[model samples]
Target chain A: MCTGSEANDLALRVAKQATGHRGVIVTENAYHGVTTEIAAISPSLGGVGSLAEWVRTVRPPSGDGTAMVADARTAIAELQAAGHGVAALIVDTAFASDGFIAPSAETRAALAAVQALVRAAGGLVIADEVQPGFGRLGARGAGSGAAEASLWGFPRHALEPDLVTIGKPMANGLPVAGLVARRDLMQAFGERVRYFNTFAGTPVSVAAARATWDVLHDERLPEHAADVGDELRGMLAELAGRHDRLRGVRGSGLYLGVDVVDPESGDPDTPAAVALVSGLRERRILISASGRDNAALKLRPPLPFSRADAERFITELDGALGDLG
Target chain B: MCTGSEANDLALRVAKQATGHRGVIVTENAYHGVTTEIAAISPSLGGVGSLAEWVRTVRPPSGDGTAMVADARTAIAELQAAGHGVAALIVDTAFASDGFIAPSAETRAALAAVQALVRAAGGLVIADEVQPGFGRLGARGAGSGAAEASLWGFPRHALEPDLVTIGKPMANGLPVAGLVARRDLMQAFGERVRYFNTFAGTPVSVAAARATWDVLHDERLPEHAADVGDELRGMLAELAGRHDRLRGVRGSGLYLGVDVVDPESGDPDTPAAVALVSGLRERRILISASGRDNAALKLRPPLPFSRADAERFITELDGALGDLG
Candidate 1:
């Protein structure tokens, strides 16, 4: 539970070795982890660790999603030309560091587009499924979101990832994570390399993981997450409409981001975010201000959060923001 | 439980980086671990890794005390001439692979002699405390034998091991291990190179370690280990006197190795060792063969074992060996 950083770095290493590439292309506001290799690639957590060479950080697509994709494509081409065998195009879904922003399909497609370019350049594709995995952010019940959103999603795997690294909230601080790759890729990886972690893949952790998944599925927590998320987002958006300092609110499912801004300029207003978090903590809630000059307050609670709980949280947040007026 | 081979290889990477040396000095027949690095140094463990050009194996002295130390000193000189810088001296304590044989004080001092040579050469001293740590094997009543022995007997913080790794029996097969280091050296290692482990310092593991240590101390397992060890050794010795194939036995307190030899030639017998282990296992009493030719049968029981338990085991082993005869 210390961080999701190590697993991300190992993922990069395995991809680099497997694909025989030195360059890693990551999202602009990406916060994959806080390790040297990851931080270098991660624009947000870069200061968290020493950034190394061969990590090409690219802008995660913005409001102008088309331009964002173009920026990433250009960045990938430059790094490839600079002799960095583009290893893997990695993207962190439910980008917590980037205002808890869920990328639009165009943004995701553009990201996927760059990945396609890397694959064309003989690179692998790695997905950071740390968050938004295990059915947290998308469809509520049994139906898959991409499948319901489009025929492509419902029919089969949407983004056929070469490797997937996951951690955080898997077992609610139980500290169990893993990397899932295509069987053939794993076999190739195992040709001469053997990987065994003393702690990871232990029976106890496996039990915890299985049990956590069972608990989540049995309770249908994702549905509850969606309902609560919608409630919380509406409440926060309404509060922002009432308060000029509150600029925006957005997210998918339970993980939401409330962007507080300067009353006069609408520029990222961080002090008010700090004030809100501190006030909320005083009321016995636990959270932190991160993303967007700490102006964006990220709210990610444990699964199985009740709708009433969301209502209560929104009530408290509304009251807190009202005091700012 | 992974193979014993990989464990040693991981240790080697840290050893080299910590010592900043290209050459590793491991005693002959010392089972460092079961990875490529360890297998190459192990003299036996079977398949070897791409043996990096940095390791220099040394012979632990025979018969004469301290000659092992002399051998290590000479080994250091040889390594330097061959362009391998002395990184650290790794000892498996009781070369259990060689019948739980311990280097004499002269040998220890001679090995300790390299302390200066390697230190001047900016090296480290690592003791593989996997077997002897955790008050098992008749160590101190409170802490590991090495910790107790080194803290009091060896010069205070002498050798100042850059890394002292201990595992097995620490959590009673709960899968927990650690490297206790001098705080400053640990800091230096961390500063120079970061080594982060996901499961190494988990909360449950921390609790397990604390509880395990408590059980060892509160139950006086170490004291019992010494008592039962003395009884077991004495009984085995007595049995050896009657059995012609039994040459001798060696060990500290609990962790004993019963040496076997050919009756006619009075030479170490390898076949008897394997047969003896197989015999014991058939009786549902688990014990493994160790030392040269697998000539010594390893007797490592839980610390809480009793004289009655030892007697029962001895009876079973005796009956098994008798059947073999």
Candidate 2:
């Protein structure tokens, strides 16, 4: 496949075949991709009401994360009652669209529980790692030169996914994406259908991915992101101490977010977020708002962002917040 | 869009919105693309039985082409009775998947009538020009220098399509494809939904398409295809006279197809096509089989194919056919 949507679509198809079911479960405000079937499951694109009947949405794990277990249980029961038994519970482990929640111990446990629950109900687990793969979250390797423990987000939650989808950053702007599935599931689907795409796995695309991977590993970009992200998050936290409008500074590695709210009411202030983003734009910085109400600033800078770049962004953000006032 | 499937999918979305209907009509063996929605309308991928309830299939025009009008009328009535009404009739004007029929005068007139009928019923006509666009059918410009009469297939039939989908060869081999639509339909869909894709219209993709277009025009590749295709067809016809298994040497420009048949029974010979194709591969030539029975040799050479190249191919084909005996 050449796009993330196609990979996710194929993932669901294989999962459905493996599970012998038709229903799917995803986070309420999740974004998978832009293909027809994948788009129907991406509530962030058109809201949950626009989702297909076979798709059920659950709240993303927040706080202690146990609440999402209950949500999944309810969703599973409802799908069972509708006679569309669960085929898969697909998740963007970064939770980027649900306001970029970092996985706490409780959230990880909850995710593990949900994975077990879905499997027990004959559903597979699909980890949409498009956002959190390729060392975007943090260092998967333990030492500077040792073998990496894990570069994928799902491994952190200790969940063994049946299917893992990766895209976008794999080839550093080239169109390349794929679905990595269990051997048994892949064999089963391969026996039934032959898949071929004219633009898939082209020589240039593969070469680009290989070059990017070599550079990423040689430069230790993931470790750099982790170090710089930690430093940047601390700077933002300090800035939040001075700016009452900025709240809830949280994220992992370079993918971070902070809520823009009304100082007096503490409610999401979309206008404030918009104004801050515009103000930053004037200062030659670029960022975007994400989540349901579009009040959380999604600060996913490039993987190679350095500490100096982080300082410049923090400095500009400080001025932008002050200008917004 | 980065693939033809995405472009066709978007075309359908716009058409369905424009007509406020859901039914789609396509040729019985037509192939649009591989996306979920588009694949359902592509009977060449699966059988017509795999079509969605909102879809109807009509036979491709063969002899005089008037028979397709009756098929369209019946399909339109069935869709209306099923309450799907008619959203669009998408046709690959080249009819590549229906065994690559050249546009005859009667078939052209029948297409015009079907277009009128579809419009009168409040449906749009979509020209899927992926196979026949960009001068594949011959020199759109008369006399090699005058402004091109028409570079697209639909204009050759004097049909004004509501939407046209193009892909694959647009940027040579790079991933670039798009949908051209009537202004009002695009406006209606745009007002309701904002479309965005991560890799669409990237600078590199745009540059690639522009470079390819420049080379195509500078070298007069379309005119070359026209000249070479004519000579090639004549050579194949001459060969067909000697080899009973070679029949129906028909097509336009460089996109040609010939039926591989049993000499004694005059029926499609899949094994013979397989053997001929495999034998050609052994001779370092490449070709493929098309049509439902996989018995028609699809001869879609590059636009730059010259008279010399055509002669070489004919020589090999003559030997291959003789070897078949």
Candidate 3:
């Protein structure tokens, strides 16, 4: 695949073809890719109103397995009523646009419940690991179990997803992405459909991906990210104690999100988040805001971002917050 | 765009958005891209039966403008009756999959006639130059006018296409493609929708495209291709006189095709073409078969293929044909 969008677009097609259904279920504020079909399922792009008729949006998992399961049931019913039975339920592991939901037992259980419900309805589960996979969510030991397999290197996750899409950091910069799925599902689709892209799987692109993989293992970049991410979170938590505007900090590994809230009503302060993002840019500490309301400061840095770099970010963020006040 | 598929996919979206129509018209056996929506309009993929309800296909111009125009009228009527209306008519400038249709005054006139009819129905014209654009076709003098603009470099084609997609050889090897459209159409789509690809327009990708452009002009590659292509076609014609299997040669610049036919019936000999391709491979000369029946020998070499290379190709082809007999 040339981009993550292509991977996701292909994933949807594979799901529909393998399951013989056309309906799709995605999380609210979910962003899978930019292609026409992928974009139609990406509610984060233009909101739920922009979704195609065959698509249904469920709210992102919020620890309450009951609500998430109930929403999935409703969405599945809606799709079935429309004559487009559920084909797949796709979700970004990080839930980046849904305020970067943190990984936890409850979160995992909520996801599993939704996946189970979709599978029971004869729909596949697609974990979009484009953002949270590839060691961005920290490294887990071998056999850490299927729950831990959402991140790269922990392939033994207990949850058996029908398809998993990976991209963005695969080749570091070169265009490369792929879809990992059950052998039977792949064979079913591959036997009938002839999928070919001009530059996909080219020698140079594959070489880049191989080199990046080798570097990641040789340097133990995931471990490095884990350590630095811990320090960064600690610093942000300390800063939050000092500044009331800093509402909360959450996320895993290097992909952390800091919430900025209105001091008066404790509501999401989108303008304040925007101001802080601009301030960080002015101070030469690059960062951006994400989530549905753009209230969470998205801090996804390079795997090699060091403790010293974290210190600089913390220092600049502190100064920027003070200046804002 | 990262690849031609993405470019075409985006082009369709832009066309639909700008024109406020859902119908699409493409040539018979045309392949534009691989995305789901694109694959629907691409008749060469799964045949006309697999075409989406909104899509209609017309025969390629074969020197008969009247028949082509009538086909377009029927397709338009079908689309209109289906309530899809007409959004755009996309064509590969070289007609590569349609066995590399040679450019001619009749071909251009037929294309212009189809464009006029589609325009009258408020549909835009999209030129997919992924194969023949970017100087792959012979070069023309600066300001050579509309007749010369069918090839790359000259943009003054009498037909002002609403969008033109270019890719494949743009960066020589790197995956880089772009959609060049009229400003108003682009603006209309851009204002309502946001489009971004991860690796597209990166510094490295852009540099590669820029360097390729500089070399195309500085090395006069288009002119070189023209000279070599003419020599190669002449040699193939000379060889055809000796071998009854060799039928006809056609194309422009580096993009040329040779027809292989049965000696007695003068009908396409697909096996003979396949054997010839294999024979050339045995001789360490690389080429491929094209056309709906896979009977035409596709001889699209690098722009820098020289007269010496042409001689070598002719020698190898002559041997292959002899061995086949």
Candidate number with greatest lDDT = 2
TM-score of 3: 0.95
lDDT of 3 by residue, A31-144 (tens): 998888999999888889888999998887776546777889899999999999999999887777887666556666777778788998899988888877888877644554
Query: What ranking of all candidate models by lDDT puts the best one first?
Result: 2, 3, 1
Model 3 misplaced stretches (Cα beyond 4 Å)? A142-150, A153-158, B142-157
Q: Which CAPRI quality tier does the interface of model 2 achieve?
A: medium
| Candidate 1 local lDDT, A1-325, one digit each (tens) | 1235545656775687687777777765676753334546766643324344566666655564676567667767877788887888777666567665455666666655666777887888777778767656745344565423321111112455788777766666555666767787778766745444444565666677788878776776766677777877887788778788776688777777778788898898888889989888888887778883767788877767777888788778877877777
DockQ for model 1? Answer: 0.13
State which docking tier applies to candidate 1. Answer: incorrect
The stretch of ten residues in a row with the least summed lDDT in candidate 1 chain A is A148-157
lDDT of 1 at A123: 80
Q: Which ten residues in a row have the lowest lDDT in candidate 3 chain A?
A: A150-159
TM-score of 1: 0.69
lDDT of 1 by residue, B1-325 (tens): 1212223434555556566666777766666653323544655343223334566656654455355556667778877888878877776655556556543655455555666666777677776667766665555434465435632112222334556767666666544566666677666656655344444556775676689888877887766787788888899998998898886777766788877888899887888888888888888888877665667788888778888999999898889779877
Across residues B201-269, which tens digit of lDDT does each residue of candidate 3 receive? Answer: 866678889999888878878778877888888988898898888877888888889889999999999
Residue B269 of model 1, lDDT score: 88
Q: lDDT scores for all predictions?
A: 0.65, 0.86, 0.84
